[model samples]
Target: MPATTIHLVRHGEVFNPNHVLYERLPDFHLSSRGVRMAQATARYIAAHSGLNHAAAVYSSPLDRTRETAGEILKALNSVREERGEQPLELTTDERVIEAGNEFRGKRIGHGDGALWRPENLRLIRNLHKPSWGESYDHIGQRMSDFVYEKVGEYPGEQVIVVSHESPIYSFRHLMETGSAEHWMWKRHTALASVTSFTFDSETRELLAVAYADPAAGVQ
Candidate 1:
């Protein structure tokens, strides 16, 4: 087996006018700016010689992630056509979906919302394990499992996984430091960002992790 690279991509901004936590909700698609961001990311990946040859592409089942992955698949297919290769297929993986949150559809702000209600204070008591929603460790474990499975399935090839912010951030943290403790400041997973991990082909050990924002200039 040869060294393989897996790119964990976060989906573009969602069209949530209510500004609520749309965790795992259905029918939440990407905004107009998000569409541009997704297209920009797809173009960037297609332009990169190393990343354009993706052997497999996986995405979360959520609509936003599916839409983002759709753009990437289109770009990848275009590149493949230019190279005279077959188009790559896209797969949906539930493990890469957004972390479950108790405050789904709730407005989180400084005002008197459900997040600030006295009854919901207990949910914030354990930010480390994150009593508010899915535990950090659980999210990390699922992400790790998904990555390892894919690595074995596609040895020596580049793979892409489009997921949500928290899951990607948790996986990155867990891989980097062997811990999944939730740290507010460390959650800097930008929308439509690509966080890549290089792993040894035989040993399957992580070699390096890199982060890039293809839609950096796009507002």
Candidate 2:
């Protein structure tokens, strides 16, 4: 049986001049530099022999993810056209979205007024389960389910999934270490990076995992 590959891609930087945690908020699109980064990522994937043959593309419903996926689709379609093949369809999956955060819209800097509030301080008690918002296990489970479903659907082919930083990193950590209890400070999933996984075609078990920053040095 042939192996199947899935690429979990993190979206580019957001246009947040305020530097607030946009977590699941609406209208938060990618910045201008982020658009360039997205384009560069798409080009990189299109040029990659292993990933350019992706059967389908999926992304989160957020604006940033949608925009990033659109750029990827465009680049992938260009490659398909060059190769005389049809373009793959793009779909949205809510399960692959950013992890929910109770601190949404609140500035977390040292001088920020919201960071020093008594109620906000109380929410920081648990870093393992993360009391401020969604638990790591929850995000890992949903991401795992999504990956299983997609790998099953597109056996022996590649599937591209565009998602946020936390979900992608959490799922990658779980797959790599078999544990999702680590603190967020350890993860360094960069913008427009690709974290890939290969699975057994028959058993659907994870066979290998890899990471790449296609848009590296493209700040």
Candidate 3:
């Protein structure tokens, strides 16, 4: 049984100049620092993993993720071509989207008096009830489905999933370690970092999960 090794990447920093909750905002490109972060992540992946064996790449449909995936491919392509190898292309998957934060489009606080307000978080925690948006449970179900399905299909291969915080966090929570209401607490995913999971082929279950950050353990 071959190992289903997947490279799950979070998208790079968005161009949130105001730094507001730019949820699902279309056309948000990578920040300058974000580009560098993507490059760093790509370099790390290239150095650590095998490009030729990577059968496919999967990413969120969002532009930020698409851009990030491109950089990873570029890194692999550069290193591989240096040694005379062809580059890999990425596939877009809707499964690994940003988890639906209930307070997606709404302002965190009044425009001038803006900050990470306590009330805003309260709103996000109870989002499943209809006043807000999708619940963490709802998001988790989708992520679990994606993880199982993707791994099943690409057994013994390497894949990349680039997506936003919510969906990816749901995946982490499902695969790494987290509860249903964990997102309610204060946890923010840094942009363009890589999160990976290695699954046991015989059981098709996750053997190990890891993140790039050394200081931060699983959220």
Candidate 4:
């Protein structure tokens, strides 16, 4: 493994923060516990092995990523200060956001009249349109491209990426060539989970995947 270790950290829990569906809600923020958990993960990253060579930090454009990356940059900045170096600044890009779910911002309930209900099922029936929401294929490709581009451009320089679960997991799928349609986040990635990839600094190929939590882990 080379020094270009990419850390893919899923944002902390944002679902039902106020007991309401936060899908695509711009105002959604990390829960108090989520914030603390994110800070803890930041500390963990600061102590992690390749971060000393970190050259950049990128995040999804969503507020969740913005917040998570902010916490991480602060921690990494502290590391920079300790090492007598300049601070690490955080940058955001949209390519790392969660695969857009058609139902974003819309209410879903098992009740009779809700969109997920049989009567209004058509509201989410079209899964392939951006108008309906981004298709899984589209999201998967975008995420893969983003990862490939990152490592290809900055070989040997560690970079921390703050992203959503869908994109993060999808990148792994790209490697395994698995059926990415599966919504396996519950079984694979957990809220605030940190996943990592070590790429060959020269070829940009994956050499390993590391997990922060054994059970809620990405393979």
Candidate 5:
């Protein structure tokens, strides 16, 4: 039986001096340290024989995810060059993009335009369901559709997907527990972390799930 593995990688830290919620916002690139974080994770993926063999690299259609995917492509391409294989190119997908948020441009402090304003609190009453923005079910469904499509396209091969925290964790949580409703504060999807799901190509059965935080020590 042929088995396929899809590694979902979260984007590195963003260069947000104002610390505003930049969800799906334009021009929010990676910070200097964030670049290093992406590099660290890229090295981790390149050093692993299985990961270096990934057939395709994918990213959310956002600056931060694209930047992170760029670093991984550089490292993976180097390995491919050594192996006489064609270098992989990146494909950005909206399905794996950041969750839509009403608090997109709000800060987190106790200021006038902060995220914790009384008006904002009303929308955030249920942390698990998230009434303020995109629902967890929608996020999980989109991610699932993306992964299943890739599995069909690359059967038995490996692929890398760079995305945001909520999409990654929501999808994984859905796969693990059959429901995407999860505590936001309890998300284990760190920046530049890799969460892999291995499946039976013929049956599309999820065989295993694994996670790694290569940039945990970057700070």
Candidate 6:
């Protein structure tokens, strides 16, 4: 049996005191509240019989995602320990990394080097095929590639992947619809949310897509 399910989890809120778009830059870890959110989501997954049994855990190479994955590993490893199974290690993959953006450190409000400046306006004209940086299609394809490869590696098993909002949602949009293009503002991937995809073990066909925000109540 090939990997049947992959849970794509969005990382918790980041510690961006400056409120600038971090976008692939380094040093953006989770906040204290973000850690709590990640813990809540991790507990939810750990208590779930299926998710707790995940054979592998992966994450985007970014700090926030790795931190979120770390929380999940703690909970899952505790379950594995009780079951006398070896703990799972975290694997960082670049495919699920945050979507690149030109406005890496730009603020959103009306001030110096804001994202809405006239010069930057040209880059944001289209959200679907966004001219800013990485296109949705590319993100979707990379995520798709990572998914199918993992599916092949772990047959009849479950896997967890922690990533940022855009990559998760873009991949979900690509899976749910034929196209990855979507209204950017309409994305439903919340912090510490999980979007699970089930695939036919033998045929590699998509079986179902499910979503859950275990940390929805977290502020």
Q: Candidate 6 at residue 37, lDDT?
A: 97
Residue 199's lDDT within candidate 3 is: 86
Flag the better candidate by lDDT, 1 or 5.
5
Worst 10 residues of 3 by lDDT: 210-219
lDDT of 1 by residue, 1-219 (tens): 488899999999889886777899899999999999999999999999989999999999999999999999999999999889999988998999899988887776656564677777767886667888889899999999999988888899999999999999999999988997768566878999999999997899999999999998998
Model 3 stretches astray by more than 4 angstroms: 50-52, 82-85, 112-131, 176-180, 184-188, 214-219
Which of the predicted structures, 1 or 4, would earn the higher TM-score when compared with the native?
1
The global C-alpha lDDT for each of the candidates, from Candidate 1 onward, is 0.90, 0.90, 0.69, 0.71, 0.95, 0.92
What TM-score goes with each of the models? 0.95, 0.95, 0.80, 0.83, 0.98, 0.97
Ranking by lDDT: 5, 6, 1, 2, 4, 3
Writing each residue's lDDT as its tens digit, candidate 2 over 1-219 gives 789998999998889977777899999999998998899999999999988989999999999999999999999999999999988888999999999988998876756555657878899997878989899999999999999998889889999999998999889889988876677888878999999999997799899988889888786
The alpha-carbon lDDT assigned to residue 107 of candidate 2 equals 76
List clashing residue pairs in candidate 2: none
Off by over 4 Å in 5: none
Q: How many backbone clashes can be found in candidate 1?
A: 0
TM match of model 2 to true structure: 0.95
Please give, for residues 1-219, the per-residue lDDT of candidate 6 as tens digits.
454899999999898887888899899999998999999999999999999999899999999999999999999999999999999999999999999899998987888988889998878778778898999999999999999898888889999999988888888999989878889899999999999999987888999999999999997
Candidate 5 lDDT trough over 10 residues, lowest sum: 120-129
Question: Clashing residue pairs, candidate 3?
Answer: 11-192, 12-192, 98-167, 99-166, 99-167
Q: How close is candidate 3 to the true structure, as a TM-score?
A: 0.80
Please write out the lDDT profile of model 4 over residues 1-219, one tens digit for every residue: 455778788887553532444555687787676677677778777887676557899998778878878888888888889889998788888888766654555454555334555534555444333335566667778877888888888877878898887777767666666544544533366766778888898877678888684223221
TM-score of 4: 0.83
Selected candidate, larger TM-score, 1 vs 5 = 5
lDDT of 4 at 162: 87
